[model samples]
Target chain A: MQKRNTEITVGMFVAAGIVAIFVLAMKVSNFTDFTDDAGYEVVAEFGNIGGLKVRSPVTMAGVRVGRVSNISLDGSTYNAKVTLSLYSQFNTLPTDTSASIFTAGLLGEQYIALEAGAEEEFLKNGDVLHLTQPALVLEQVIGQFLFSKAEGE
Target chain B: MIDFIRSLGRWGLDTLQRLGSGHLFLWYMVKGIPEVLLRFSLVIQQLQSVGVRSVMIILVSGLFVGMVLGLQGYNTLVDFGAEESLGVLVSLSLVRELGPVVSALLFAGRAGSALTAEIGLMKSTEQLSGMEMMAVDPIRRIIAPRFVAGIISMPLLAAIFSAVGIFGGFIVGYGLLGVDDGAFWSQMQVKTDWYDDVLNGVIKSIVFGVVVTWIALFEGYDASPTSEGVGRATTRTVVHSAFAILGLDFVLTALMFGEI
Candidate 1:
C-alpha cells in the first residue's frame, strides 16, 4: 500500500508538471485568454485598417476597455466594418466618443484608441461610433518623405 | 606522413569499436524491458532518485535563464521602443530552444554522471555477478528501472524548467523593468502559437531524454570493474551525453524547421 502510494504521488507530480507546461505555453504564446470576458458590442467604420487584427485591444485613455471582435469590408462603401466588444462596466462611453486606430510606441503594435467626448447619451449595443479615424500607413509616409527629398535635391 | 596516416587509421578503428560496443550495450538494456512491468517498485524508486531529487537544480537554473533573457530582451527591445513584447520574447526562447537544450545539459551533468558512477560501483562490488549466480538477471532487475525512470523524468523536468522560467521572465519584465503589465501578457497571449513553439520544445526534450539516458546506462554497463574504471565511465557519460544532446538538437531543429 505504501509503495503504491509513492508511485501514485510521483505520477501526480509528473501530471502536474505537464499541465503547468501547457498553461505556460498558452499563456506565453497568448493562445487563449482565461477570461473569455462577457461584454457589449459596438460598431465602427474605417477607410483603412492597415494591419489591425481580430482580438486587438480597444483602449480608452491608454487603458484597455474592449477588444476587436470582428473585422470585415463593406461592399459599397469599401470601408472596414470593425466590431468592438467592450466590457459591461465600460458601457457608459458617450455616443460622441471618437475612435481611431493608433500605433503603440514608434513601431509597436496597433490598437483602437478611443477619445471620449461630452455627450449626455451613452453608447449601447448595436450603436455605431460615428467619429472614426483610419490607421496611418508607414509605406505611404515613407514614400511621401522620399518624394519630397528627391524634389528638394 | 606515414605515421600520421597510421594514427588517423587507428583513431577511426577505435571509434568504430566504441560505436559497436555502445550498440550492443543498448540491446542488452532493451532486452530487460519486459521485467520492468513486473518490477514496478524498482521503477518508482529510480524515479524518485532521478526526477524528484533533481527538481531543485532544474528550477533554480530555469529561473536564472529567464531572468537573464528578460533583462537582455528588455534592453534590445527598448532600442526599438517596443519593450512591451518582452513576455513573448522570453517565453518563446525558453519554450522553443533554451528550455530543452539547457535542461538536457544539466541533466547529463548531474543525473547522467551519477547513474554511471552508481552502476559502475555496483559492478565493481561484484553484485551483478552475484545476482547472476542467484538466477536473477541484473539488467532486468537493476538497469531497466533506472533507464525507464530517466526517460520519464527528463521531459517533465524540461517542462518544469520552461514553466518556472516564464515567471522569472515575468518578474524581470513587468515588476522590475516597468513594461506595461497588460501589454506584456495580452501581446504574448495573442501572438504565441501552441503547435510551433510549445509542442516542438516538448518533442526536442523527449529526444534529448532518450539520448542522455541511453549513453549514461551504456557507459556504466561497459565500465571495467574497478574504481579507476568507474571514475572514467562517469566522466565519459557526462561528456558524451552533452555532445550527443547538442548534435541531436541541431539535426532535430533543422528537420523541424526546414521545408524540404
Candidate 2:
C-alpha cells in the first residue's frame, strides 16, 4: 500500500508538471497562434519602419491577422523590406492592400495595420505590397509643427 | 604568530582537498546513474520523498510571490499611466528571474537541507559502511537515485512556481484591481517569448538542481562520523548551495542575456 501510494503521488506530480508547461505555452505565450506552417509570407517595403520589431503583429481593421517575420534593408531601393507572415485564413487580401505602421495606445507597441483597396487580384506568396505607409516619427512630427508655425509667422 | 600561520596553511590545504573530492564525488555519481536507471524503484522512492513532498511549498510560495509581484507591479506601472502593461511586467519578472531563482532558494532551504541531514545521519550511523561491507556500492545503491530525483524535481518545481505565480498575478491584477482581462493575457502572450524566456528559465533551474544536489550529497558523504560533524555538514550544504546558485545565476544570465 505504501509503494502504491508513492507511485500514485509521483504520477500525479509528473502530470501536474506537464499541465503547467501546457498553460505556460498556451495562455501565457503566443506559441499556438504563431506557428510557421499556419501562415503565408508577404513582403512590404517602407521608407521608414521606426521602432518596428520582427515579431510585431500585423492587423487588419484592428484585428491581428499575422506577424512580421523578418525585417531587412532593401539594397536596391534603400527601403525597409519587412516580411509579413499573414495567417492562411486571410489569403484573399486585395493585391493593392495598403499596409501602415500604427502605434497601440499612446505609448504602446507598433503594429502593421492593413487597409484593403479596390483590387480584384489577391496577394500571394512573394508578392510585394506597393501601397505602404511609413511609421510616424514623433521628432519629425514635432519639427514639422515648428516649421509650419515659423512659416505662419 | 607562527602557530597562526600554520593553522591558515592547514585550512587552505583542507579547502583544496575538499574541492578535489567534491569533483571526484560528482564523477562517481554520474558513473552510478546507469545503475539508478536499471533499478528505477529506488528513484521513485526518492522522487516521493524529494519531489512530490516539495510540491506544496513550491505552489504556496509561488502564489505568494506572484501576488506580491502583481501588487507591486501594478503600483509602479499605474504611475506611468501604463497599468495595461501589468501583465507584461508580472509575467516577465516571474518567468525570467524570480521563478527559477526563488524556487531554487526555497528548494535548497526545504529539500536540500533535508537531503544533507538524512545522508549525514546515515553516515554517522555507519549505514553506508555496512552497505560497503555487504559488497554494495553505497554511491550506486543510495546516492545516485536521490541525486537523479533532485535533478528532475528542481525544474518541475520551478515550472510550477512560475505557473502558479502567473495565476496569482492574474488574481490580483484582474480580480482585485480591474485591469482588463484581454489586455492582461494578450499583452503577456505578445511580450513573453517561449524560446527566450521560458526555455532559459528551465535551463537555469536544471543547472541549479545539479549544483544544489551535488553540494548536499557531497557534504553529507564527506561528513565526519559524529553527531556534531553531521550537523555542521548539513549547515554547510545549505550555505554552499545558496552561494553557488547565486554566483552561477550571474554567470549564466551574463552568458544568456548579456550580448542581446
Candidate 3:
C-alpha cells in the first residue's frame, strides 16, 4: 500500500508537470501559432525599415495578419526588401494594398501596418507591394523641420 | 613567494585530478544507464523521492517569485505608463531567465543537498562496501537511478515553476492591479516566442539538472565515509551547484541569444 501510494503521487506530480508545460506553451507563448504554418509570403521594398526586425507582426487595420519573415537589402535599388508571411486566411488582401512601418506605444516595438486598397485583384505569394512607406526616422524628421524653418527664414 | 607559487601549483594539480575523476564518474554513470533502464522501478523510486517530494517547495517558491516580479515590474512600468506590458515583462523574465535559474538554485539546496547526504550516509554506513562484497556494482544498483531521476525531474520542476509563476503574476497584475486582461495576455503571446523563450528555458533547466545532480553524486561518492565528511559533502553540493548554475547560465545565455 505504501509503495502504491508513492507511485500514485509520483504519477500525479509528473502529470502536473506536463500540464504546466502545456499551459506555458498555449497561454504564455505563441506555440499554437507556431504549428499553424500555412501562410503566403509577399515582398515589400522600403526606403528604410528602421527598427523593423524579422518576426515583427504585420497588422491590417491594427489587427495582426502576418509576420516579417525576412529582411534584406536590394543591392541594385539600395532598398530594404522585407518578406511578409501572411496567414492563409488573410489571402484576400488586394494587390494595391499599402504597407507602412508603425511604432507601437511610445518607445515601443515597430511593426508593419497594412492598409487595404479598393482593387479587384488579390495579392498572391511572391507578389510585391508597390506602395510601401518607410519607417519614420526621428532624426531625419527633425532635420527636415530645421531645413524647412531655415528655408522659410 | 616560492611557497605561495608551490601552493598554487598544488591547488591547480588537485583541481585537474578532480576534473579527470569527475569525467570518469560521469562516464560510469552513463555506462550504468542500460542496467538502470532494465530495472526501471529503481528510477521510479528515486523519482518519487527527488521529484515528488520537492513539488511543494517548487510550487510555493515559484508563486512567490512570480508575485514579486509582477509587483516590481508593474511599479516600474507604471511610471512609464506601460503597465499594459506587465504580462510581457513578467512572462519573458520568468520563462527566459528566472524560471530555470531560480528553480535550479532551489533544487540544488533542497534535492541536491538531500541526495548528497543520503548517498554520503549510505557510504559512511558501509552499505556500498557491502554491495561490492556481494559482487554488486553500486554504481548500477544505486547511483545511476538517482542521477537519472534528477535529470528527468529538474526540467519538469523548472517548467512547473515557470507556469505557476506566470499564474501568480496574473493574480497580481490583472486581479489586483486591473491591467486589461486582453492586452496583458495578447502582449505576452506576441512578445514571447516558444522556440526562443520557453524552449530555451527548458533546455537551460535540463542542463542545470544534469550539472547539479552530477555535482551532488560526485561529492557524495568522494566523501571520506565519516559523519563530518558527509556534512561537508552536503554543503559542497549546494554551494558548488549554485556556482555551476550561475556560471553555466551566463555561458548558455551568450551562446543561445548573443547572436555574436
Candidate 4:
C-alpha cells in the first residue's frame, strides 16, 4: 500500500513538472516589453518583410525598446504596414528615426532595429516613419557577391 | 565442371524454395486478418498494461534527451554568437525525427521482445494448439492482443517523449544554463510551431507501433514448435523490430518531407 501511494505521488509530481515546463515555455515565447499603460505606438511601412515575424523585437542602438504588434498590407500601395508598440518612457524618438530590418549576426534571426535621426522634432504616436529598409535576404547578398566576383574575374 | 554445375543447381533450388516459403508466410498473415482484428481488442487491453504503465520511463528518457539537447545546443550556438536560436534547433530536431524514433526503439526493446517471447513460449508448450483444438482462434486470442497493445502504446509513449523532451530543454537551458529567461521564452514563442514538429512525432509513432507489433507477433506465431524455437523467436523479434523501425523511420521522414 505504501509502495502504491509512493508510485502515485511520483507520477503526480512528474505530471506537475511537465505542466509547469509547458506553462513556462508559453510565457517565455510570448515575452513583451510593454508595461501597464506605459507604452506608445508608431507605424512604419516597408516594401518587403522577408522573415520579419510578429513580436520580433524593435531595438534602438542595440537596446530593445519595443516590439512589432501587427503586419498588414496597404491595399492601394501594396506595401507592408508594420505597427510598433514603443515603451512610454521612450517617447523621444526623432521624427526622422529610421526603422530597418537587420540581423544580429551571421545566420541569426531578423529584428526591427531603429537608428535615431538627428532631427529637432519628436515623432508622435501613429505617425509613420519615412525611412525604412526591408530584411537583407542571405540569398540576395550571396548572389550579389558571387556575381561581382565572377565579373571581376 | 559437372560437379560445379550440380552444386550451382542445388543452390538455385534452395533459394527458390526459401523464397516460396517466405511468400507463403506473408499469405498466411494476410489470410489471418479477420482473426487478427477480432483478437486486436484484447491486445488493446494488454497494450494498456504494457505501454501505459511504462509511461514513467518514457517521460524520464524524454526529459533527459531534451535537457541534453538544450545544454549542448546552447553551448554550440553560444560559441557562434547565436544562442537565442536554440529553441529552433531543439524543437525542430526533437519533433521532426528524434522523439518518435527513440521512444519507439526503447519500447521495442523493453516490451516488444517480451511479448514475442511469452507468446512463443506458449506456442512451444502447445497451449496455442490447445486453443485451436477447442475451436478458439489463437491469432484472435494471443496475437491480436499484443498487436493492439503495441499500436496503442507507441503513440502515447511518443507524445510523452516529445512533451518531456521540450520541458527538459527548458529546465536545462533556462534554469540551469542561465539563458536569458525572457529571451528564451520569446524565441520559442515567436519561432516554434507545435503543429509541425509535435504532430509529426505522434504520427510517426503510430506507424512504428504497427510495424513493431506486426514483426513481433509474426516471429512468435511462426516459431518452430520447440523450446529452442521460443528462444530463437525472441532474439529475431528484437533484431527484426529494430531494423524495421530504422527502415520505416527513413521512409516516413522522406514521405513527410516530400523528399521522394
The candidate scoring highest on DockQ is 3
Instruction: Give the candidate number with the greatest lDDT.
Output: 3
- Candidate 3 vs candidate 4: the TM-score winner is 3
Over 4 Å off, model 1: A1-9, A30-141, A148-153, B1-6, B258-260
Model 1: what TM-score?
0.72
Better of 1 and 2 by lDDT: 2
Put down candidate 1 lDDT per residue, B1-260, tens digits, no spaces: 99999999999998999899888777877888777968778888888788877888998999999999999999999998889889889888898889999999999998999999888988999988999999998888888888888888888989999988888999999889999989888777766667667778889998998889889988888899999999999999999998999999989888875655
Query: 2 or 4: which has the higher TM-score?
Result: 2
Q: After superposition, which runs of candidate 3 have C-alpha atoms over 4 Å from their true positions?
A: none
Tens-place lDDT per residue, model 3, A69-113, is 999999999999999999999989999999999898658989999
Per-candidate iRMS values, in order, are: 1.9, 0.7, 0.6, 6.1
Clashes of 2: 0
lDDT of 3 at B222: 87
Candidate number with the higher lDDT (2 or 4): 2
A109 Cα displacement, candidate 3 (Å): 1.7
lDDT of 4 by residue, B176-204 (tens): 87777666656666565444445566679
What's the TM-score of chain B for every model shown?
0.94, 0.98, 0.98, 0.83
**Candidate 2 CAPRI level:** medium
lDDT of 2 by residue, B53-121 (tens): 999999999999999999999999999988878899988898888988999998888888899889999
- Write candidate 3's Cα lDDT for B131-164 as tens digits: 9999999999999999999999999999999999
Which candidate ranks first by TM-score, i.e. highest? 3
